[model samples]
Target: MILNARSSYSRLLLMVVLITVIVSGSSRAIVHAAVNVPDNIRVAFFINLGANKYQSLTSVATLQSTDGMNLIWRDPQFSLPAGNVAAGNSVRFAVDGYRALVLETADLNAAIAVLKKIQASSSAAFVTRLTKSGKPVYQVTEGTYSSAAGAKTALTKWTGSGVATGVQTLISARVAGPWAVETGPYSSAYEAEIAADQLGSAGLDSFVALKPREGALEYVLRVGQEQNESTLPALQEAVAAAGGLNVRIPAAGESYALIRHDMTLNGNANKPVDFYAIPAGSGAVLRADPAGAGGINLLERSKRTYRGSMEVSVLNQSLAVVNEVDYEQYLYSVVGTEIGAKWPLEAQKAQAVAARSYALSSGMGYNIAHVVDTTLSQAYFGIASENAMAIEGVNQTAGEVLTSQGKVINAVFSANAGGITADNATEIWEGDDSFLTAGAESPDDGPQKGLLDWYYVALSSGQAGYIRSDLLADSGQKHISGAKYLKATAEGIAVRSKPQVVASVEPIARIGSGTLVVELDKVPENTDYSWIEGPVTPEVLLASINKRAKPQITGPLRTLEVTKTGPSGRATEVKANGVTVDVGVSDNLRGALNGLKSTLFTIEETGRYSILNGQGDQVDSSGQIGSLKIIGGDGTASSVTDPNLYVMDGKGNLRAGTTAPAFNFLGKGYGHGLGMSQWGARGLAEQGYDYQYILKYYYKNVLIEKDA
Candidate 1:
């Protein structure tokens, strides 16, 4: 019995060891990777969508509320609720039966004059442009009244020379129409605008609306904005009187309702609603609620899905798209996108804590908004980045935030740390945070050997792609020196069908070592922790940097060198072509040298590479040239850029190319190299560390606790 028990114990111990090995190794899942409400604190992200993708005015937008949208009128004082837009989802309550008083005018300038008179008479006036019978028309409307009888009473007083004496206007009720002189249902605003321009050249005023089309978005361009014409017969009569191109008025169920700051979109799945809000007080918001659980807020443009309700409103005339949800719930997407959707749960948990602290503390968005949806405020890509692991990480670390001296710390982290993190926030940003101190993971002073998973490589033909780090045989040189030029073990090394990555990708090109190449960067699978980006001359570097400089580099920029460095060898100040770039902000120094990837790089003046001829003597350039072909993963080889020269002998015998890059920037550690290193956290997590341990390791003297 003792012998049998011993044998069983040994088997159990082996099983545990095997599980640990599997968990620590190659665990990346093969997945290719809200604000508003006073009762509960939330975050609002100003996402650039549709036409607002570039402009401040969001002329077109798609808003979906999960529980149907309701309209609420503020007290007559017109005090905009806390965040400029309306606060609290009106799903709770809405007082209905409000009628809008609209006055129609043929000329826009005349409408503007009439609108001024209405507002002067104690009514909030808004101007709207609409298309009636293929003709452009303008309307100036009063905000709203509790009853139609009340509206009519005001309309009579206004018509009796109270608003404007000789305006030549018609009084209209319910300003949206059931028909329009329409064009198309384009897939994107860009495409619709192109088509709209074609119609404009033929003398037609055009407008576009981003609306729902069969479960997706349709950028619909019409002859004019929808305006007040309640019936089809009335529209037909007006079109006949104007007489141009025959209007193809859509059939019934096609409805367009619009107001500058007030919108009413009842749950008519068939109708396309165009809702905008004129800033009555500060800004106006209109929320569209979805049908049910099956309803989607925004489908990440194409393939992504998110939880919670989507609030749509106009801020600065741009459609401000905000995803409103519980604060902890928002982190599901935040943690996933910030780190990895399929990374080990503990690593993502650390990310969740850091992201929460940073977002809550940095109020770097539109008013009442805590953060933006970019690296400018940490990646928050909504539902597309969320996964099972992300959900777990966020839920497991719910409300947990890192705080220092009773305030939430700005836990800024980057891709890699080289080996040790930066001394403090001063290395990257302006001020220094006591907790953002250096923390070393490994004993090495730099990137560990063989730790790199992917390499930014140029082919023998000088084309760019990535190769697995393991496939590269060492060129008998340390990476801390000049530049990394790897030698392949065999001829015809296969490149990935996917650029800048390897692992489970298909093989693309079969090029041999006869091609001289430059390995620009050595990054891990999930972090741009190490990179190299130049050969740019002082003049070229000066041109790229001067565009962003205030005390710009003026004279002939001939000399460039780092004058001062931080604790992590990150450049704090630099002499750019003899000009001292000692600005108050350290980040400017990072952008000085051709906008380098990071400041922790050594400048290497290259172009002295020696090539061997058949006679065993080395020369600067090769005497004979070899055949070369460039292959692309895009399946179109002709699309890639190339030079008109070749010199390598096409086999690995040290034959240099005709021309080599001039100044190679050999660098390590991406980002500002401050605070926690994301890849370093990932490595520690894989080594069986918990979230709390990882957080304390990178951050100095910080307490991990629930904020509320």
Candidate 2:
């Protein structure tokens, strides 16, 4: 029968409700609040910074009141000295420096000490004072102010008015009821009724009553009896179940109803109709004829039409069953009768044969029947079976064929033409004689078929026949290869210019350590270094040559000069004897020059030089010719005079009293020391370190794994 959209929706809803009841054994319940907060306190602000750099400041600081007004700065400049400030110190900046300094205490004592310290310091140029009536009032004592303007005016006026005292006031507010709940009171009966209706619609019951308080009549809307005692638990459950649901509850004996002017159903304004159920397990059948006298006129109304459709409600034993009469069949039969043709003959014969076979298969002990639409050529045969062989065979056949063709067939029997295909064929082996064949069509023509021409016959449980072949396309299976690790030596030894870029000749991976890597289609060439091609794999190798070479240090040569002095007696007479020799001198000069080797020294060539003994007395002088000695004298002998130059060791250690160029490579750490050190890694590895352990040591506590 043809059903309208509204009827169909109602039927679906009925089915859903029936299924829910059968599965869960209970209907869903709505939740309402039991208690709510009363006082409306304006939230100044909400700070949610956790235990971070700002948490301590917010927790320790307190808002202060001065002149009967509470004052709290949104961004007060306050700090405690880094070393002195403990975890929870209430601190504020006085005229002291910008650096955080600890407060002596949380009260006026600390505030006074900080103020006095600021006043004594010469660097503090700003004056601290209280304010009264928008004017500065200096205070002989120190305290927190209620407001910026008040503090300034009080301080200024105090200086002129000679007020040396201030009072501190603190405000504490208490919260009542559920801190986060919102509630309202209802005064009108109409409003309460509306609220009740809303709550009832939400599956929650609400009541309305008069709350007599101090002889005054007050209407109260309360959650209905079903939820009064269990409101809190139910509310919590509902919130946990479906995120959040609005809830409300009234005081004892005071009924409360929900406010529902803005209520909606499943988020939609329009409400959906409720669905009713018609019994299906048992039903009576329509007989072919009715007796004349006591019998009712069954045929006349039995085949009655309802808006081009018909419905039959039957009682079978204790069960009531309802079935739709195929209107299409009735129309077809009427047309056939008018034309005087045999249009219904085929369906009638098929049903009769099915009924007889069903009865025989059931051992003739139980009743069997056939419900048929002759004109539409469709029929349903029901039977009581001992073994159910026929039903089982039909179910098995249909399941196998449909599953093999990847077609989904519903459990119930129904006639559908769209799912039939030429490659998927079906034939009835027992109970009925029928075969289905899907008509062939070109790809461009699409499918050209009719429901009447495609027949399905059920024999056993879930088994049926259908047109076969060409129903499903063939799909190929895929084969996957196993993972493999590849090994290869570095073509040449060189150091990478950068970590990834090969520079000059440098050592690559160790000689015997086999670096497992994935194989690639191509190798990078003439590009400093080649990547592993793919992910590095694990493989054992006896040895691997370094891929990069170390860089050679090449530059201009540096020159260093050396000088020696002659014996004190010989050098002193050079000018007097008029001797000018640039070659070898005496044993003392040779000894001093040998000692000066490997040491840097400054040489001063004075026309005349006086040699002093350890006692600081001049012993001899080189006159006219010249006198020279190593800048820093030999360790055992003193110099002829004070020297300007000093020598330095390879480690840049300065030699006493010598002028020499410092060593070129005298820095801390080892290697180039600019980036990660391979030597360091080797050192760690030699000390029994894993790859991840090595990486963590060098890169701080960072993790290393496959590059996901």
Residue 208 displacement in candidate 1 (angstroms): 18
User: Model 1, range 233-330, lDDT digits (tens) per residue?
Assistant: 54444433444234455553342222222222234322223334322123334444344443334422332445555555544323455555667767
Cα lDDT, model 2, residue 341? 27
Candidate 1 stretches with Cα past 4 Å from truth are: 1-44, 47-57, 65-257, 260-272, 280-282, 294-305, 314-318, 363-365, 442-527, 537-540, 555-557, 582-584, 607-661
Residue 362, candidate 1: how far off, in angstroms? 2.6
Give the alpha carbon lDDT tens digit for every residue of 376-471 in model 2: 122221111111223322222211111101221111111111111111111111111112122211011011211111111111121212211111
Minimum summed lDDT over a 10-residue window in model 2 is located at 536-545
Local distance difference test values of all predictions, in order: 0.55, 0.23
Candidate 2 Cα deviation (angstroms), residue 76: 76
TM accuracy, model 1: 0.54
Q: Pick the candidate with the highest lDDT.
A: 1
